[model samples]
Target: MIVADGLEKTFWHRPNAKGVLGSFRALFSGVGSAKKAVESVSFAIEEGEFVGYLGPNGAGKSTTIKMLVGILHPSAGSVEVAGMSPQLQRREVAKKIGVVFGQRTQLWWDLPVRDSFEILQAMYQVDEKQYALAMERYDDLLELGSFINTPVRKLSLGQRMRADLAAALLHDPAILFLDEPTIGLDVVAKERIRGFLKEINRVERKTILLTTHDMDDIAELCQRIIVINHGKLVMDGSLSALREQIGLPTTCTVQFASTPQIQQIRGIERIETNGMQVQVFYDKRTISTPVILDEISKWGDPLDITLAEPEIEELIRRIY
Candidate 1:
């Protein structure tokens, strides 16, 4: 439903001169440097797909999202959303997409949450029946009824986020652009938001593009992931594909009653032991978890154990 072909965005950085007159002269002079925020990035997102757009700080994830959403025009190449040019047909594209920024709110601060919905309803030209139905669905999913009458300024972060999600989907847009929708939210709040998004993507079939630093968000919500670094597309595929590409080891930390004799295991990459705790790292593709557990059991009596898959951060770090 979205395509970016050779998309690029460059921002100019101009430094002020020492004196006022020099500063004015610098403004007219070509004395600034160009920084490419996104470079030759290309990708296609199919309909009803939830894709995670990931990168570290200043990696151009936001820049790409802006171009796709028509907030910023790319310096090179082309973009299409739902078969229409977002740059040329911005108004029409706006009708087909919804956007939510974690650090910003589209709702009025002093107005009640209900007022914001009514305002957006009028702005989107939604009919009364459709509006009622949307509200009913959102209320059921988001539980907005608890704070519908409260002023937006008085609501908690979780409440505000839930309300914002409801407001964004009230128009029944075909796509959703979520930029760190779970950032700064508590664990409970984040889980709630994730659950709501999962339902929306499954039942409503809303194509979503999410940009987040949280690996759990990517793991739980996205089926595909697009990783970028230094303004260039580095990786694009499923999480399993990414792990395979990076060749990161799966680790199992075990707390035994005491230190036991460690032996050579074919698939085991390495082992670290500190007092009662021992951590074994291995390639999961080469050996199954049950086999690993059985091998470790022969070493000693286990008191506690925890298994962890390869982390997204580790993959991105290796890519960088």
Candidate 2:
């Protein structure tokens, strides 16, 4: 559904100085220096696939998305979405994709939520039957009926987000581009959006490409992850495979009744203790749960235990 070949984007940023003299210099010299934000990156996403694009701040993630969505032209290489070049047929491509930018709202602030959808229905040239269905479906999935008559600016953050999502899907696009759809949202709000996305991808067979800093979003929603760093493609694979490649450790924290200084157990690779709690790192392949539990019991009275998988951000940190 999406293909990018050797895609690249360079941005020229002018140095900013304090005074009018600096402004004059910038005027004469134009952009002071240039930096490559995306370089020789290429990948293909299949139809109905949920792919996560992950990177740190200013790590070319947004640059790649912009090029793929035709928001920004690439300096090098080619992009094709749904068999059409985004550069050549932006209008046609736009109709086939639903975009949700978490940091920005595409709806009119002063208008009622329904008005925004009405405007999009006209712009997308959707028929009354399709429009009514879209509204009914979004209202059902997003629970937008409560605030459908309210002005967009008066809605809560979560409500606004839901409304924006509904607006994006009004035309029933085949591909979805979600750029941090869960940002600044509480747990409940995030789960609501995630469930909606999962349903769209599963039930509707829509291709989805999601970019977010939240590891949980990626972990819960994406089966494949594409990692980028320093303007280059670093890793792209399944979440489990990426974790194995990066050597991200699984943490096992156990609380003991008393502090016990101890040597390494048969399965424990590393051990650290603070007060009455013991933290251990072990390879799941090398150590079974029964063995670890037996070793922990030998130390002292066991109070509690919690096992955690490494988050995506931690994995990215290790990769970079």
- Clash totals in order: 0, 0
lDDT of 2 by residue, 167-281 (tens): 9999999999999999999999999999999999999999999999898898899989999998999998999998788766678899887776565787567888888888888
| Stretches of candidate 1 exceeding 4 Å from the true structure | 18-20, 253-261, 274-278, 285-306
Backbone clashes in model 1, listed as residue pairs: none
Model 1 lDDT per residue over 1-320, tens place: 99999999999989868998998889999889999999999999999999999999999999999999999999999999999999899989999999999989999999999999999999999999999999999999999988999999999999999999998999999999999999999999999999999999999999999999898999899999999999999999999999998889999999988778777788789999898788999998888889999999999999999999888778877887
The candidate that achieves the highest TM-score relative to the unseen native structure = 1
Best by lDDT: 1
lDDT against the true structure, each candidate: 0.94, 0.90
lDDT score, residue 289, model 1?
86
Give the residue spans of candidate 2 off by over 4 A: 16-31, 252-263, 272-279, 285-307
> Candidate 1, after superposition: displacement of residue 164 in Å?
1.4
Q: Compute each candidate's TM-score over C-alphas.
A: 0.91, 0.87
